[model samples]
Target: MLTSFYKMHGLGNDFVILDERMGALPLTPDRIAALAHRRRGIGCDQLVTLHAPTVQGADVLVRFFNPDGSEAGACGNASRCVADLVWRCSGNATPVLQTRAGVLPTSRTPDGLITVDMGAPRTHWQDVPLAMAMDTLHLPLPGDPAAASMGNPHATFFVSDFGMVAQGHALEHDPIFPERANIGFARMDGPHHMRLKVHERGAGMTEACGSGACAAVVNAVRRGLAARTCAVELDGGTLRIVWSEQTDHVLMTGSATTAFEGTVDLAAYPS
Candidate 1:
């Protein structure tokens, strides 16, 4: 079947979005991976699928799939992109999205940026699901990285420079993180700003990673290296991340842009 899709991006972390709200589409993991292959298919950092909401107060169900075809618990940038799409279609500035992680509330800021309340950050080793218990604030890793969960596991390495970012691939598969982890290399520019580069699990290095920014900020705060609210500069662009002290929720604000819209025959791709 030919499926209609939207080519969208939050910063430069692009996605191929398929709306399955009206009906279920024949989308297997391999098919999704095929669709995300840069040389062989539509090519995107990730594939997002929208389905009918199954929970109360949610406008839609958002699912994120990595290029490797693994399902991710949450994706901050993708959420903003999906929220923007839903808001434009329903004419609602605020839209709630349900995902594997939980319900997330999103809204459009006065400046035309989309903000997603990414809920509270998780710090427990159990939450990160480490192979064993350890202090999340100062992991035993070489760079003394820290770990946090924004639905999915993340390990942030605060560096004086970006030279150590090359270790991301090895750290991601370390036995300590049983479920694997997104590795973020953060360089503090100041208490209120930082530069970031992430080797996302399954998706490799991307131009931007919203959840990584959130996790990096949360981890930085825990280490007393950054303030609760900070600006994160990624390769694609910058994102304003506010770790609200009152709610303990992380708010990610950024632009979601549509590159184009197109249709593809699922049958033509590997299933």
Candidate 2:
């Protein structure tokens, strides 16, 4: 079967989006992994699928899959990209999307950037869902990393340099995390600025990571290393994150772009 897909990106973190709102597609783990293979199939950091909303008031249902064929609860960059797609399709500037994490409200900025209200950060150890109970502020780890959940597990290690990309892979599979985690290495440039590199859970180091950026800012604020509202600089671009004091919701602002769109034969890839 031929499947139509839209190729989109948010800050260089690209995705191959399949809209399944009208019809269902055969998407197994093996198929997803095969489709994500750079050389053999359509290459992407992740695959996004749009489905009919299950919840009332939600404009659509969004699902994210990693290159390893693992389903992710939340993805910040993909959220922005989906919001843009929905807006262009339905002409709804403010669209409500339902994900495994929860309902996400998205809006367009005056400057044309997409802003997603990522809800509040989950700070408790059980919320981050560590292997065992421990202080989330300071985990019993070598680098003294902090843990927070932006709908997904994340561990942020504050370092003086941003060259610890290799450490992210090791820490992502660490035993402390019950489920694998998106490991982020952050360096505070100032009270309102930070530099970050994230080794994602299923996908290795990417050009950008939206949820990782939010988790990094939340962790930095908990450590008093950064202000509540700070600019997080990822490899691809910068994202403005504001852990709102009034609403307690994290607002992530960035740009989403359409690279191209095309159709592919599903039978050509193995399931």
Candidate 3:
């Protein structure tokens, strides 16, 4: 049977949402890409689906796929959108959504913004899943491989300028990472702030990436270039990331807005 969905965005990090409490639709990468297409589809940066918990005793499961069809561990803006939608559907004040990174807690604020506690950031080499064993904070991108977790995996590189690189270079062809990774560049401004040019896996070059911004800060700080908490400016906008020495997890707070919402004709999507 065909499925129903809605569209939302958090600081230009958009998502196509499906509240599958009863599991009506099977979400796949190709389908996600189809729905995210502006020319032939609804168009979004990410696709979010919420369903009953996969593991017993856990809260609802929130799954996400980038426009490229790859599933991500967590998404800050998308998580907020998911929390708002779940709360609206279930009438629960505080909702939990399980992800690969583990259980994430989200609450609907009076201002209508969804606030999520993104468990923690895994900064070590093993936790960040770097193939080589070494210090994750300072380890240079093997090639295009700059990876860190804002409860998700991201890889970035330092470049003199981003205007020279093509948009969305693939990981498959890059040698630094055996498994393809999200590629981007970091341009430094000072001891506390910098800018990012991201070629997001699955989504290509988005206006901004929330988790990516956090990863960029950690990457710079670990490398002894930037401060823990600073303003990260991206192509789309800016996000403030706080990485406390006391708490390993990165805290990302941003704005989310409900753009228009409508259901797509499933038949119009690709198989």
Q: What is the TM-score of each candidate against the true structure?
A: 0.99, 0.99, 0.84
What RMSD does model 2 have?
0.8
- Which pairs clash in model 2? none
lDDT of 1 by residue, 162-195 (tens): 8987787889999999999999999999999999
Off by over 4 Å in 3: 55-59, 87-93, 107-114, 134-146, 167-173
**Best-to-worst lDDT order:** 1, 2, 3
Candidate models: Cα lDDT each: 0.94, 0.94, 0.71
| Candidate 1 vs 3: which has more TM-score | 1
Please report, as a residue range, the 10-residue window in candidate 3 with the lowest summed lDDT.
Answer: 170-179
**Number of clashing residue pairs in every model?**
0, 0, 7
Off by over 4 Å in 1: none
Shift of residue 25 alpha carbon in model 3, Å: 0.7
**lDDT by residue for model 2 (108-172), tens:** 99999999999999999889879998999899988899999999999999999866778888888
| lDDT of residue 266 for candidate 1 | 96
Give one digit per residue, the lDDT tens place, for model 3 in 37-124: 8777888888888777977645788888877777887777787777766666679868887887788766665766555767666666
